[model samples]
Target: MINQSVNEGKTAAIISHFWIIGLIIAFIMNMSKKNYFSSFYIRQMIGLNALQFLNGWIVYKFLGGTAGWIVGVLLFVLWIISLFGAIKSEEKLVPVVGEQFQNWFKNF
Candidate 1:
């Protein structure tokens, strides 16, 4: 059963890593299936998207080029880590902010 859920959700989990559009698709897929594996990844993607907006847009707006670039790279690294986890069927969170994401998006 666990293996099946992981397999079923793996695609959605991977899809969730492709930024906004992928997140949307993964979310819709998971909505019907309601599997824990997909939900875990979807929630993480949503949180990453939020942070990307907050740090990318807002920070870039205020702090100018360099800070925004650095943060963007960091977020990209985090995204890579998250994507790898999804790919491996692992629930590893993306460092510092991962826990916060899980808590905030618990309902998803």
Candidate 2:
């Protein structure tokens, strides 16, 4: 079952990690398939993009250069980790808010 999901959804899952455009593309690709694997990464991308927006608005605006940089790096690392897990056909959460993302975006 796991291997089958990876086979069917790998392309969409990888594309979903590339930010908004990729998220849209992956979503379209998964529309017919309704792939669990693709949906999982799509939810992750949604949350990550929200974090990106917050980083831009709140972190960069109020936190100053050093703190903003730190948070930015951390978010990037989380993205990389999640992307790598997708590549490896793994379904691990995206660190802190991953579970929340899954719960909140369950309808997707």
Candidate 3:
């Protein structure tokens, strides 16, 4: 049972840890078969990354380095938690933002 989920989307799941690489792998995998966690995690990570980038840029431009560092740390923690959940086959989301990801990325 566990092995089946791993075998079904293990590549995508593992790839997702690599940031962009995992995302691409998930996209490709989705083309053929659907792995629930892999697809959700991929989209979640992409959205998170985009938000982080935008926040960092805006903060750096306006608030400077200190604010950016704070936001970056928070995002890092979220990423780690999300990765852990996906690896464990748990559908847990990263605190507040995770549930939204699940809902938003349901189609994939």
Tell me, by lDDT, which candidate is best: 1
Looking at model 3, the pairs that clash are 15-22, 16-22
lDDT of each: 0.93, 0.91, 0.74
Better of 1 and 2 by lDDT: 1
Cα RMSD, each candidate? 0.8, 1.0, 2.2
Clashing pairs in 1: none
Q: Over the stretch 1-108, how does candidate 2's per-residue lDDT look in tens digits?
A: 878988799899999999899999999999987999999999998999999889988998998878888988999999999999899999979998999999999988
Report the candidate with higher lDDT, 1 versus 3.
1
The global Cα lDDT (0 to 1) of model 3 is 0.74
Can you tell me which runs of candidate 1 are displaced by over 4 Å? none
* lDDT of the structure predicted as candidate 1: 0.93
Which ten-residue region of model 3 has the weakest summed lDDT?
2-11
lDDT of 3 by residue, 50-93 (tens): 76877768977898998888888888888888787777766556
Shift of residue 14 alpha carbon in model 3, Å:
2.8
> Which lDDT tens digits does candidate 1 get at residues 25-51?
999998876999999999899999998
